[model samples]
Target chain A: MSAAAAKAKRAVRRPVSIASFAQSENVRRDDQHNEVEMLMPVVAEVFANIGITKNDIDFICSGSSDYLIGGPFSFVTALDAVGVWPPMPESHTEMDGAWALYEAWVLLQEGEIDAALVYSFGRSSPGNLNEILALQLDPYYLAPLWPDPVSVAALQARALIDAGKGSEEDFAAIASRSRKDALSNPKAQVAHDIPVETLLRDEYVVSPLRRHTLPPITDGAAAMVLAAGDKAREWSDKPVWITGFDHRIETHSLGGRDLTSSPSTAKAADVAGVADGPIDVAELHAPFAHQEIILKEALGLDDGVTINPSGGALAANPIMSAGLIRIGEAAARIASGQAARAVAHATSGPCLQQNLVCVLEGE
Target chain B: MSGQTTAEDLGPVTTLATPIRLDFEFTPGVAQSRFLRGLEKGRFVGQRCPTCGKVYVPSRGSCPTDGVPTTEDVDLANVGTVTTYCVVNVPFAGQSIEIPYICAQVLLDGADISFMGLIQQIPTDEIRMGLRVEAVWVEPEELTPSLASVRYFRPSGEPDADYETYKDYL
Candidate 1:
């Protein structure tokens, strides 16, 4: 083992804060702009809102998948949108933007860099999103079958019903409420005030998974600035403090695991201290409506929690960026004083195989 | 034992070849659209960064160093200098150009960045840094919104540029 590995554990207590956040308007197809173009305005807005330049940032990390664009080295090309002239420390995650934020958070805990920029973008309109997502499955068994995300999610929904954990009505209700809440959010692509009955009447895209239950195919980008210690206070008067952050992943084998409950989410919640305080709001990255029920239960959130006030992923799911947007949305609420404490969740892999939970609070 | 195994001897095959092919409709975005349109008109257009005043050909909409958009459009001359080059002596699949062809980073005058262009009409050994060159465009009738509109670059016969002129670009 290296000398650094042999050292005593370093408890990172340096408070990190979500200083600023911004997101592009979600659309069905952003034909006018490429991923970099879609991301430029959002990155600019994120930094502009905080009255700082790229020079103020010490580290930059982003999350995106090349599969969406059917190209490689896209993240490297994406740096053009950020203007890495002097060349700064940068990193990327092929998972979700939330994971990028986790990386930046870990970097900050080391107490070296004062701030970091986290951004992500996805254009689901370019390719067959369903077919593209199936590539994420295990190559040996699950992937050869070519089960799309909707079909996989349907299996989870069916499992939920089989276990008596949730009903199809519960899925409709979540979809209805999420879209209704999205009506006020201009960034949401699918927003409406539809009743549960009306939503249920909609035809099922897959068994037990209606068109309303599945997240809208969206092209969008989001950015957030994280600052530590004095920089956080200097940047925002109402800095949203990230009290606890943790992520966990379950087994990749779909047949081997229980689909009804998200044990990974429950574990992440415990590690993130989700039950330590009352959650005034939550932004869960449940691409399918029924999965929201699983997440709410896993996080141990009751009826009092205002879920997905920004319409959640149901309104606009921009693949790689959707998960980070949850964290940003949750922080925005706390920063605005709309909520004192908030829980943000991001999920990846088929049927929530991986999960991340972040607890945000305001002073 | 035989060199090849039978199905019974092979047991369950552990490997699978599942070829996944996905098509995409690429959108080049606003800045590249401008550059492509410029090519359609037989002009080399670039965008200048507002902060640094460095012009980028085929700007992807932002100044990479400053993380800001290059908004100002500047029409550039067809003439430039070869900042760097390599001879493709080895043949490979999807190889369109002949072997020993010169592929070079052409730094257009008044532009801050260099873009790859095929350097031809000269011997491979003759290609060198700071070599002056000029774009040879496609026939006007065949012009389209593509880099192909500028077919290639050839020796401009102008005096070699000072090494300092394009060292930053290199």
Candidate 2:
């Protein structure tokens, strides 16, 4: 062993693949129902599809933010959908639902549990997400300016523009492409095939980023079931196995890192083996139109790969659930035997500071 | 008339939630135990990795690079340099300062690691990268086992330095 190896303990590693996944329609805004009511159907559907109950779940994990709910420990009330009267083993991460999947994957790596249920929910329409995200900034210094999410994203857009990497027209092209592809997706909320020139005529929410480039404010939820080894075989005729998974976080301060490039996404792509082979479909959770381009380059996807046939975050960004929805969409493709392999990505924090990437496959 | 500030008018009104300070005495792990204990003793200590010979200020017992517990304790000065910083235009929950203040990354002398702190004894508008700074240690009798023991960083009367000095620091 090398000198450092003598000091470091041997780390345990194993493989845990996804078995099932489900999500609700990407709504523009679920005004009639609250978050709990909106999330229940999605969870119930997953349980019914798998022939399982709350008690059958060995572990339960979820992801969300208190800021979105405008209350502390907002996730506490979410347990109602979970029916925690018996108090099943549970934990929560204040991140995207994909990270919750990562935590469940870790638990499964312990080699004790056979199945886990992961979920996430958010209602962005209740409060302005752009203004709410201002809280993530440094307390004493930058946060008081109330630098909303769109403005931060706009700043990054301008930086990319100044760097000569791309332009506003390019952003419009991404939106037009997404909406055209989403036209076939029954669950897509804001799917349309408006000409790129028509989209360019739209007014800017923050300069360089038009309303079309941003995701629709939405309220939704999602759930995914994970099983490994023999348990995976019992789930379906075609089980989409999680072959690789990894994520990375950059500095919280936007000024500290290069806004034009996503090193975190690039690093996570490398760790998750996104470039290993032919990825039939790649679902990216880029909330902004230009971000899709940055993430595409960062992930190193070629023209042959499919990008978000399911409208993606731009169509209906439900705060916390939007990223997780990408995973669900990617897995749905493989579970239905449409694609043999797929890649899904999720992002959180301002300007996509943290990202999670997972590769799904069918045997 | 619907005279009340009810749910419909506000479009999903929330119960007012304010900045809450969630204070927990997170006991420093074995790797950070001595380093914290030293702070309680009012002594600035650093840990030296026997192999890499790099020292960490706000000393950690484990060399982050070596991943091994550090054996030797190296005492350090209370002085450091203001690496890079931003003007705080907003206030946040659990913050002890008012608006228009400066939060800087301080690279302590003889230490490879950097830590965050409030910059005082200088105008927020005048704060710049690479500003020399020194810690204003709290009264020995009033010191607690928390990072708040060091009041803030104050100007050390050094000339303004270039960005390259701390450009890569961020």
For each candidate, what TM-score against the reference?
Answer: 0.94, 0.66
Model 2 interface CAPRI class:
incorrect
Clashing pairs in 1: A82-B67, A83-B64, A83-B67, A84-B64, A85-B65
The 10-residue segment with the lowest total lDDT in model 2 chain B: B20-29
- Model 1: lDDT equals 0.92
Name the top DockQ candidate: 1
Separate DockQ for every predicted complex: 0.75, 0.01
- Estimate candidate 2's alpha-carbon lDDT, on a 0 to 1 scale: 0.78
Tell me candidate 1's TM-score on chain B.
0.91
Candidate achieving the largest lDDT? 1
Per-residue CA lDDT of model 2 for B5-66, tens digit only, reads 76666786355444533222222333355566667777567778775787776543444343
Residue A286, candidate 1: Cα error in Å is: 0.8
* Interface Cα RMSD, each model: 1.0, 19.8
lDDT of 1 by residue, A1-363 (tens): 453542222223678999999999988989999877889999999999989999899999999999999889899999888888688999999989999999999999989999999999988988998898998988888888889899999999999999998898999999999999999888899999999988889898989988999999999999999999899999989889998888999988999899989999998887777887899999999999999999999999999999999999999998899999999999989988999999999999999999999999999
